[model samples]
Target: MQPAAPESAAPAAFSYTAFALSLIAGLALGIALGRLLGPLPGGEAEPWQLRAEDRNHYMLAIALEYHESGDAARALDKLIALKPAGDPLVALAEGACALGSGGYLADASGIAALRSAVQLYQDFGREGCAERLLPEAAPAALPAEPPPPAADARAQPTPLPSKTPPPASAQTAQTARLAPTPLPRRFREHSLRSFCDIARPAIIEVRTVDYLGRGVPGQRIRVRWGESEDIFLTGIKREYGDNYGDFQMEEGVEYAVDMPGAAEPLATALSTGSCYSDNRRGLKSWRVSFVEV
Candidate 1:
């Protein structure tokens, strides 16, 4: 029977299109499974990746620890690990201000300590508004010494000591007279100038200094526009003078600048109107200064 027609031996041809479709389907299934499983192990967020508020808290904790241990290097290392966008010192100081402004320092000795630690850094040129938000802590009251044990009534009383006024001298009088009470220091506007430049955009630049004209770091500056307000501190940008701080201004908007306890705003309303420089029109810029009076 013709060898049963050789059993019709013939292999089925492979479909390249079917292979490609199967490959694509497998890849998609793998991706879906990965999504359902979430991130792989050890994928925890880094300390630098913490949320902004959490990062502030982290900075405060570091400052408090630094206060207790006085380990500035360790504290600095820890702060650097946070990967702050600005100076670590400034970040620390801002954290202190945030804590104080947020009412987180009420009866919180730890937070107060953190603020004190930040102030110590301020002396080194690190600047922030912490001092305005949180004043220095008052000294603790000294304990009263116990009165000498009363002499026993039975013991004979000693003769009363003579009370004689010593001869008055210039030194004695000078010592006795209380030094004239010093007047409280206040800051007054030193200078205010406005200009424009094509290269530099509009800004409110503020500088604070002592009576001696020495740049004072860590001074707080407040800027209000519309209903919004912002505070900044000097010395945050060391490249600029330690007393230098700046705020960018939006075109056609007015802003008020002030400091704590000032009689009034430094600039009741500083308008960012147009100005000409180098024969080219541009937004206006301001340079204002304050000095201790």
Candidate 2:
């Protein structure tokens, strides 16, 4: 029977051609599918790709320019593009713009937003900025006198005699012409002594470091105390230790802190009452540092 036609022999030429065609068809199908799908939205240039410091600087610059130029609408538009919707810094900038633009001043929400921004800035140690955002106090109105009791129909008006000053003598007039000498005003120099007076329990120091244990600047640190929350930007005055984060804490209350851009946030807290009181504490603040591992 011709040795059963060698059962283990390779496939025919047609089988090889079929296999080659199948492989080619699969590659073509994959290419067509890829083209149909296209790239994902946002593509490779994603928001997360931006460094935190760069983003903050960019936003702050835009905010400052808007603050100077009084271009509220444009500033708001740019801020919206940056997506700092819930960020207090951006909110402060927005409030400044609104105050300049005049239109938003009448809106209740706008007023509330500015107030919130002020509080946020104050808590975060940006008191100067907060003060700027604060609205000017309205002047108090004087009480109006009641109209002369409707002309009493029966009562006759009485005229009162007025006293006139006697003619002044030449010597008396010369004395009157003399003005009191102006007194020199005393100026008090700014001092941190008041800050030093706070008790230790009320002071807290914060610092930040990178993976190398070196100081990190331009960090956004958020602290929560009881029902209140505050946020501060690090490195404003590097001379006072740019990486140092200093804040006052209420005695007996606990505080929690975190850095916004940290991959693994180094959260820490303190119970103020646990520490000893120091008379010089106000001048000396407490400190905490976030170190990347």
Query: Best-fitting candidate, measured by lDDT?
Result: 1
lDDT of 1: 0.70
Candidate 2 local lDDT, 1-293, one digit each (tens): 46666646855656877788999999999998886675643455443334554454455555444434445456556656666435434344434444534544464344444443343333333332333444575212222343466478876655533332223463365334333323321111111211233434366566666666666554566777778977775554455665556666776677776654342323335545432234232333445666645
RMSD of 1: 15.4
Off by over 4 Å in 1: 1-185
Which runs of model 2 end up more than 4 angstroms from their true locations?
A: 1-201, 261-268, 274-286
lDDT of 1 at 222: 87
**Model 1, TM vs. native:** 0.46
RMSD of candidates 1 onward, in order: 15.4, 24.0
* Residue-level error in angstroms, candidate 1, position 115: 4.8
Q: Rate the local accuracy (lDDT) of all candidates.
A: 0.70, 0.49
lDDT of 2: 0.49
* Number of the top TM-score candidate: 1
